[model samples]
Target: MQGYDRLAAVMAADKGLSIFRSFKRLNAKNLLYLQAEIVNCESELDEIIEEDKNSGDFFREKYSTSVRCLKEGLGDETPKQWVKIRQLRELLDKYNTAALQYAQILRLKPPHAKDREVFQRWLKENAFCSTTAEFNQWFGENDENGGDLVALFGRYENVDALTRWVFRIAIPCFYKLVGYRKAKGDVETGMVYFDDDKIIRATRVTSTITSSAIPATSMIVLYLVNHMAWRLAIIVVYNIGFSMLLGLLAKARRVEVFAASTAFAAVQVAFITNFPRD
Candidate 1:
């Protein structure tokens, strides 16, 4: 009876081991399928972009909000098309993230079943949490209270926010384009930001839908200067007749002034051509 009981215990252990091994194999197969699916989706997206390159009418029509058109296909199908593509890519990204984290957790090889269970639970909870704050909180860590990754990348709060928006709005695109993980540590130098801390905080909620070669603050200043310059030019042109009445040589003065204006215009053109707007 004692011998039979010992044998039964050994058989149970063997069954558990077999089950674990089978799960590992299944996971590997799923990961491979997901990666292949991502590649296929990427190729299809490229084809779509190429087809719409001429007038970019596809992009324009897709965004149009006209009431009559909205009732038809454009409102529903156009947005829906992008949404479906995004979901596929997002799933692939989550798979990759999970695999990487799981490999790390496995390497530690916890000595007890309880330890292993804890590690598994941690991975399950943290794997899909989008932001570092959520991940830290899930682990029972006070992310906001501590000197967290958010503070370290304080320079890039705006950029990070935009990245999140891009991911949410363009799911397929978010997955295809490599994204910066909102972890609580150093992000790579490739992540962009503004010099002004105030700008970063202020525009943290702003979208990066439009690309700008210059910093947002600098771009704003340039726009204001140009607007004021146009107004100043208008004022100067309006006062030209008043200047002509100041002297009998007003006609000759006007000719001289016109020649000077043409020369200045040529100089301005040369400057603009040499230094293109970012």
Candidate 2:
């Protein structure tokens, strides 16, 4: 019959549409999973990059102080001073290692000749010296000036300034050189899309609880006031006590949730680390 054929065709079309929608949903979920993995990888890389920057900053601070002392005729001749010098040297080495590792991890290829030349020129002009010879020459000229290269450039008011001008100057340059924008973009996106969802869900739940509580409280108050005026004062006190108890319960729940989330994160880390990688 014609009606039977039409029904059969309609059923087949519905089935096909359902299968197509399911396939699309699965593909979408797969894409989201891949995006999450990429974001996590970038976050880890950003943390490492931040560590490298911190090490570099530490090295610069220690190096500047040590160099200042040396220029001021405060030689590291004593055992204590020598130990400090050795520690500073170790930090410098650590900074260099971190920088190299960062560069390798980021796969930073050699810069263009023009860009390299420009950077070298900036180093010469701003840093007071670009090479070892120039550095030695500058230090030797310290007697001509009242202070050393750092003082000559007026990099800081004094040794106690701790906030190094050179470090501040280098930050923008390093940020560009390290290609931090990509990592920063991924982090921003993840925060907006992933973290925002959690925040929104919490807000909705809190709103629902609050909206429900207000009406319920009002109804209880009204019932007490109308039916039992004598016991109204006691009911009010009871309501206040119940509210305080609820507040404490909410606080405890938050603490428990925080602990559970921390545990889950730890387990995830352990699982990922132990899992075989190809």
Which candidate wins on lDDT?
A: 1
On a 0 to 100 scale, what is the lDDT of residue 220 in model 2? 44
Query: Highest TM-score: which candidate?
Result: 1
What does candidate 1's lDDT look like per residue over 1-278, in tens digits?
22324323432432211112113445577777777777777777656544444435755354333434323434446543355457666977777886885564344321223222333353343354556654444223532322111111122122443333332344334334643343232132111222244433443323232222213433333344445455345335433432332222222355765775555445444443454444
- Poorest 10 consecutive residues by lDDT, candidate 2: 14-23
lDDT of model 1 at position 64: 38
Per-residue lDDT over 9-123 for candidate 2, one digit per residue giving the tens place of the 0 to 100 score: 4324322111111123334455556556555655664554454345654543353346554333334443233344455456556555654554443342233233233323433
* Pairs of residues clashing in candidate 2: none
In model 1, what is the error at residue 5, expressed in angstroms? 16
- Model 1 scores a C-alpha lDDT of 0.40
